[model samples]
Target: MVIIKYYKGVESNLYNYKAMQAEIKNIDLELNELKNEYNGCSSISYEEKAAPTNKFNSSVENEMIDRRLKPEQLKIKKHKLEVQLQKIDNALETLSEDEMHLVELRYFKKLQFKVIAERIDRNEMYCVCLKSKIIKKLIPLIFLLDK
Candidate 1:
């Protein structure tokens, strides 16, 4: 579906809140993979040589520096992603349960309003009105451009 967004005063077309959450989720997944790699010690390992050697001998005997990220670096990255996810979670927590549910169906699940109404056992118009309310509530929390 087509989505439009305006940053500052210029008009740009894209979904914002959903994309933000999606990015956070992606970062979390990446962090998990990094953690698994650290735990498994699967990252490449190498020894450093103190002095230069003959090119052929060095190439044969000395492996290149691992160039792999240290586990500590992975931990730092994971911590940062977790902190960002926490911020997003805190912002989402401002909504009531019902409002949050509607948002999840509409944006997260990308469900149609009619389907959302059916799932919630509400009339279509009621669902639309509720969505409007939810947007108003979320504007301050998610849509910084709205300010």
Candidate 2:
């Protein structure tokens, strides 16, 4: 496939795949905490006021609303992360075993090119070229950058 345009931040997104997975785990923990915080609490409450006015709300009330919405926000974030993860996963699935290993060594393990070359039994130049090709291949798969 031909790449018409090099999408900005594709390299960074590829490099940060492992970090993104870790973030998803953290989000899960946060969502659990939020859920536990509101467990057994009344979902409905009644408040009496002198007049039925909705013009303004107290800071406390606003904070409470924000807190209540926290889990939904977190869920949205988690879903985004999951989608990115799925894209990366699908891209990885398309790679050959050697390509996958190169990606794991270079990106997931954060290895230097020299080290990766040594590990993969290839010359440094070959490793560099292969890495470039892999990134190009993945850009289309991961980002759907092909037109």
Candidate 3:
């Protein structure tokens, strides 16, 4: 089925748009924090490189026994989060004003539908319906954009 696209300012609400933009900022902040943590652990200065490469196993094992297991796991987790953050940012960019607003309120802000409805002046049922439809549209867009 073909989806209809709305023109700029067409059935779009300003409050929703602003809400989304703000939520995007929060996601960005969170993404940056994750990246910073990842960098801290993965840094390689010349001094660090002075050690034998094989030292990694001993150092890592020591850290693990001291309750710092999974250095590699942290890297993988950071990578996954980066991918997820990119998808969310790209999806936010592609959304129409209306859909973007709905997604921001529901997912980004982590608001329940009833609360979103109250804020946006819509019925909760309608907000939930719109949210589901917007999510459906965004899912593949995110996947394609990430690829």
- Clash pairs, model 3 backbone: none
- lDDT (tens digit, per residue) of candidate 3 on 61-108: 444453333434554565665665565577668778877778767755
Cα lDDT, model 3, residue 116: 91
Order of the predicted models by TM-score, top scorer first: 2, 3, 1
- Write candidate 1's Cα lDDT for 1-147 as tens digits: 111232221111112445545665666676677556423323333543445655433332222222244445555765665564554466568878888898788767778889999999998899889877655554445445344
Backbone clashes, each candidate: 0, 0, 0
Which scores greater on lDDT, model 1 or model 2?
Answer: 2
How high a TM-score does candidate 3 get? 0.47
Query: Which prediction has the highest lDDT against the true structure?
Result: 2
| Highest TM-score scorer | 2
Better of 2 and 3 by TM-score: 2
Each prediction's whole-model lDDT (CA): 0.57, 0.78, 0.58
TM-score of each: 0.46, 0.77, 0.47
Model 2 over residues 11-67: C-alpha lDDT tens digits?
677788889989999999998886666434333334534466775554456557867
